[model samples]
Target: MLLTQYLFQADKPLKTTIRNYTEADFNELIDIQKECFPPPFPSDLWWSEDQLGSHIRHFPQGAICAEINGEIAGSITTLIITYKGQDHTWEEITDNGSIVTHDPHGNALYVVDISVRPKYRKTGLGKLLMQSLYHLVVELKLESVLGGSRMPGYERVKDKLTPEHYVESILNGERKDPVVTFLMKAGRTPVKLLPDYLDDPESANYGLLMEWKNPFFEKTK
Candidate 1:
């Protein structure tokens, strides 16, 4: 993929800016996630007063958030393959082993979760979260960012990808997720699986894996 030859615009990011997460941002984060996701994560996800205390201690500068004109709109929890002084590259995350882990040595950023209240969906806040995660990865010096290209409570649905990537950003639907647009703006390419690696991902819609990084970040910024 010759991104440099394709069309460059690092001077303008996905039209969204980001900031750090804070207490005042918790309620909105909860509201948006709740509105977009179901079965909600542990109640602590929303009511925890330890909000910043939880992520900041774990990710330090990797936990990023955003606002739309002073209003809290979106947030993302990021883990570097290498964090602080330790590396988490050997760790694997699972939603009941439903999704497969392909790369343990890949340099990528995983977006643990992202949400923009239903009211805000299709309105660009989700794009903000994607952009913020992209920025966080650059600061951490990572090459790619990955997360489930998922629908909220996605296990009940089927994925579209046949095989998942080491780090995948995917979504379900008859169409590509708006996040795909932002991802393209950031420059992560999809993997072309070897015939042996081709198989249905255990999660929904095969898994719409997307990746982003580098010149995409530099040119967009």
Candidate 2:
């Protein structure tokens, strides 16, 4: 399916056009990433322009960008992966590298990254990007979408609670975590808490494994 057609069909709140990533978007996206995730993040964790290009080359449709006023305001990078029904960690999937491990025949759409520029965030661009992912999942006939959710607000209470407990609090409404709350509101469920999932100081090096099943997906032999 054409990315343009999907964007036109999906419900969006802002005046934005969602399209596949391009080489020119590389620098803007890198700058946006820097703004969204501030310093203290390991330099090696950041994907170089070439690595971002590799993702676009491997999964063109999976690399989506939201354009607002002729500028790249947000982006979502994804890949297909065979999800084994077992406990998994982020490192096991990415091999602790910037390169994406996209499996074309995999059954699940694995979201590698999703970010909205700091200036444009909370303007509904993030939701639009997620809608693009939903459309992509339908287009690919994938069963579900999966990704790690950084608990950015965890550090405030990390000294008193375990990662699992922190996630439980968010799930049960006992506490509010920015990323976890966003994912839950987007129809994703927190399946597990992964320790040391990413090198983010804000999340205390932890992540919540989130999944959203495609209600319209049909399984075939």
Candidate 3:
């Protein structure tokens, strides 16, 4: 089944709440990353305390968490940047995850990371977190929300297909990638295929550039 179908399957409503992640949530964020991106995903790539601090300090509005029954189930971290609207690497754009480059006056919201604990994956926590980010884009009047999504399914076919072809297959409905498909259903459009975007062997170091334009974005004079 496609991710869209799976993610939307009938289920009981969750007692969930989405709110900005605070310094108090730092340790939980670390645990979530481990559950979401275990080994083969380099431990170094996980968010550091310094990086989390940068997120909360630089642009707290762009960093959010989801709670289910008062337990932190997932989180999304982001920063505001004057997007150059060109091909770029994850480390470069995110300042190696510290986001010290976050510009409060920038016009775009860049998603640095989003993670949901394994136990809560089916509770729609991911969707809720993304919805919060979408709301942030509109609330800040940014032009768009940008993110690089790993294609964990890519490594399986790396020997048989190039990264570009892999993404094309997903886009054309000839294939299904959990991360890619889920993001598509969440309203993110794939605008580029990025290579060496991260150190995840599962994705073969490939990432998909996902964008969601703010429908309410307006040019200022």
* Best-performing candidate as measured by TM-score: 3
Q: Write the per-residue lDDT of candidate 3 for residues 49-138, one digit (tens) a residue.
A: 898998888877778887766678888889988877677778988899888889989988898888888887766677767777888888
lDDT of 2 by residue, 1-221 (tens): 22332232234544578888888889988877887767765555666787787877788888888887678888888888899765656767754434367788999988788888887766666776887888888878899999888898889998998788888788788989887897787778887777778777788887788888899998886
* Candidate topping lDDT: 3
Deviation (Å) of 212 in candidate 3: 0.4
- Tell me each candidate's RMSD, in Å, in order: 10.0, 3.7, 4.5
TM-score for every candidate vs. truth? 0.54, 0.87, 0.90
Candidate 1 Cα outliers beyond 4 Å, as residue runs: 1-17, 38-52, 82-91, 94-106, 151-188, 192-208, 216-221
Ranking by lDDT: 3, 2, 1
Candidate 3 accuracy as lDDT? 0.83
Q: Which one wins by lDDT: 1 or 3? A: 3
Clashes of each: 20, 0, 0
